[model samples]
Target: MSRARLSPALVVGAAISVVFVASALLSLVWTPYDVAAFDIGHRLEGPTAAHWLGRDHFGRDVASMILLGAGNALAVSLVAVLLGAGLGVPLGLLAAARRGLIDELVMRASDVAFAFPALILAILLTAVLGPGAINAVVAIGIFNVPVFARLTRGAALSLWTRDYVLAARMTGKGAARISLEHILPGLASVLIVQATLQFSLGVIAEAGLSYVGLGAQPPAASWGKMLADAQTLVSVAPLQAIFPGLAIVVTVLGLNLLGDGLRDRFDPRLDEER
Candidate 1:
């Protein structure tokens, strides 16, 4: 087997993702200072040898907070995407296999889901379930469901019309078997690209929810919460906000670039053009 070619964007994106993942993992084991520890004297101090990214208004080490915050962001995004893809992929596959009323129903349900924005859905869920990381994940996951479902349905529909799919049908292969063995494999690249894009969106959605006090609660050290806290002290200590903001931007950019790279790599039309 030949090794797959790596795109420059994919390499850079993967590097960025690795760095963040490593930081998050390291934070799980150790942080320079207690993420919750506060010192009035050190509050809002600029970066120093002792505290690389300085301290927040509460005197919590910004670097430590960011490190741990990465973990929170990744965890939420990962769960959200998993939940979305887990349910959405099946529904999409089922719809594609059945077509007619089932497809209409699935697509219509997705439309209804798309009608509500993530933030609004988050707020609604928070009202019913109260605020936390799980709620945020559910909200984001719900939002992602329609996206994957639509993409899967479209991709699977195309595959269903192909000669191999017809041959499998003629060979007495059930829809479920054919979808699992054939359609799903063909849709893997597309799903992967979609997942990357959705993961980034989930991260941003989690941050937005957290910023609005609907995500990870106090002492959790979410990037969004950090930004929310820093907004009041932006002028006095811009780094507090800057560090978390930069984290969000870098994470999203990396995922998006990775998705683009994967799309270019997987799409045959793009290969033909090259």
Candidate 2:
């Protein structure tokens, strides 16, 4: 098979993702200042020799919080996507394989999920479970399930009609076996692209939740929470909001670009169109 050409979007997205990932990981070892430590003496201090990005209204290091926030955002989004794709992929496969009522039921359920927005679900979940990172993950993950299920089911439906699938059926291969071995593999590229897109959505969802006090509670740095905290201070300490805002924008853009690139690479029709 011929190697796929790397697109500019893919390269740039990868580079941006690498920077965020590296900063997040590096935060595990060191930050300019302790994330939780605060100093009333230095509240709202601008960039200087001591604090690179300056300080928040609470006198906490903005740079440190940002670095740690990257980890938080990445963790929550990663778990949300995993929960979504893991359960969604299999359910979709089952629906496609069984057809008839099974397919209808699954599709209907996805519609129900789609009816409830992620923020609404997060609010409800937080009300029931109390706000935290885990609840954010669960709420976001639940919301994501329907998205993956629909995508997977749609992609698998196409694969089920392919020649190899017919040959497998002729060889006495059961629906489950064929789906696991053949159908799933055929849908990998589509699923991957979908996963990347969903991951960016997950990050945004988590941020939105955190912004409203439903995610990664107190002392746990989050980009959304950072924005929330900085909103009032924007007139004075704009850097506080700016840094986190940029983090969210850059991360989402990178993931989107990566997803678009992957779709182009995997779908021959897209390449031809380009």
lDDT of 1 by residue, 1-274 (tens): 1127888888888888788789878888998889766798878999999989988887878888998999898899999999999999999999999999999999999989888876687678776877899888988888888899999999999999999999999999999999999999999999999999998898898899899898999879899999999899988888888999999999999989889888878888877666
lDDT score of residue 230 within candidate 1? 89
What's the TM-score of every candidate structure? 0.95, 0.96
Candidate 2 on 51-75: residue-level lDDT in tens?
A: 8899988889999999999889888
Which residue pairs collide, candidate 2? none
As for model 2, its CA RMSD to the true structure in angstroms is 1.7
So what's the TM-score on candidate 1? 0.95
lDDT of 1 at 1: 13
Model 2 lowest lDDT segment of ten: 1-10
Off by over 4 Å in 1: 1-4
Alpha-carbon local distance difference test for all models: 0.89, 0.88
Screening candidate 1 with a backbone cut-off below 3 angstroms (N, C-alpha, C), the clashing residue pairs are: none
